[model samples]
Target: TLRPGHAQLAQTARLADLEQRLARVEQAVGATPAKLSRLGVGDHSLLATAQHLASRAALLDSAQLDAAESRLTTLLTKLDQVAEKTAAITGSSDPDRDKKINELYELAKKTEYLSQVLPQTLERMLALQELHQQGGEFAKALSEIESVQVQLMAKMRSNGETLASVEEGLKTSFATIKSNMEALDGRVKALSTKK
Candidate 1:
């Protein structure tokens, strides 16, 4: 007689083995991009989201926060498209599978919210950049803000409690960044008036 725990362990082992086989198949097929293209799985909107992220990196490198924000905004649209396309591909025929996919879709929406908040945060950074007289302090603050953005992005991909904690962290970080930027803006303005 198999114990319940033993049965659960066996199920887990089977799942792991199946995942390994699926990965190998994907690797073999992925190596031949042209074949996949011909088979009509190419041009996925998910790739478009990746392309937007690449462009966002370039924008950030150039210190174009506003442009980066715009790019992220557009990426949100692409994310929506990808979610819908994915749902169409893996239709809601099975209740259990549909529930799992719905979670992914919800995550995408949350990512869009993060993207929206990111620009607002970056705008605050841009305002701080205008106060270049405090270069060192401003740069350090900017670095921290960017670090938060990275953390939030990573958290958005996580499941359950980690994701919830990161979202709350982002809210706090944004509030702090905004408050600091406002203070700096006021200080810069006062100094300019004195000059």
Candidate 2:
């Protein structure tokens, strides 16, 4: 329903708006290269850092990995040598080892039993000494004897306790040593079999 003059005016306004939009798009496009250059600078630094890290990783793989492998090989060799030396010293087979341990254990038990029984024996001896000392003339000598006997019993008890403790310690130590040796022997056998 518009007249010819109005239609021409509307078309001119639309064309002007389109031209303004085109100019703005051209301005953004013109600025794009500068923005990309700034981004490229950041990317270059990041790429350099990544390359440095990669080189370090490669160095670690070549140097540290080889060193670790060599150390492990050396340790294994030493273990093998120790195994061989142990076998030589202990002999290829020890049938008496367990028997000896059992005998030592039995001896320790007997020693412990004797230690316990010794105090009772000393007490009985003291009782007998007291019965014999009822006469006045022998009283002083009996007193002296009793004192000496008491001191002797005390010393014996202390020595017995110490001996028992020492024996127990030796027993525990020997057992631990035996266990460790057995474990080592098993490992050596396993390693030898593997080879």
Candidate 3:
């Protein structure tokens, strides 16, 4: 009887120790990403909200000014949070964290490009929405936005790949990307003459 009780107590103690270890692991996992940590200790709620807003915008069938305005408002709010957190972590507007981070940057620049192109796109979408409201071609506006988005995505992906190839370090940085492999060669020639 005594041996059985001792074994049970030992098992219970082990369980408690396991729980404590799990809690610590959870904290470390939550703290791993600095930008996310800045937002809060363990709630990615706002970033999720922004993602939801973007999803909503994508699902929206028509380009009503009100809908676009709502999406823009949500995106701007989320961007503000991300920018604050990222700037705190990186200390610069452009933070080069890693290859994946570089990909994100390229993708973001593509979105910015879309934002620039959006006024015109929005105007077209608005016009089509108006046409739809009055019983004209409403579906076409959605198609146009989809097409532009697809093209924009492809371009960003291409740029990301290209940047990744050349951005490894001085080890991989090429003179060809500088408009001439011979540019360095010319510099070398000039240096030789000076010596």
Candidate with better lDDT, 1 vs 2: 2
Residue runs of model 1 more than 4 Å from their true location after superposition: 31-33, 43-195
lDDT of each: 0.79, 0.81, 0.74
Q: Compared to the true structure, candidate 1 yields what TM-score?
A: 0.20
Q: Against the true structure, candidate 3 has what lDDT?
A: 0.74
Error of 3 at 134 (Å): 4.1
lDDT tens digits, residue span 1-195, model 2: 999999999999999997687668656554344543554433233334446567777868867889989999999999999999999987876769868988999999879978889999999999988777666548888899999999999999999999999999999999999999999999999999999
Q: In candidate 1, where is summed lDDT lowest over 10 consecutive residues? A: 41-50
**What are the models' TM-scores?**
0.20, 0.29, 0.20
Model 3 per-residue lDDT tens digits across residues 13-97: 9999976876686576553456455644344544453465677667665667669789999999999999899989977664445
Flag the better candidate by TM-score, 1 or 3: 3
Which window of 10 residues has the lowest lDDT sum in candidate 2?
A: 40-49
Candidate 2 matches the true fold with a TM-score of 0.29
* Better candidate by lDDT, 1 or 3: 1
For candidate 2, the lDDT comes to 0.81
| lDDT, residue 158, candidate 3 | 99
What is the alpha-carbon RMSD of candidate 2 to the true structure? 45.4
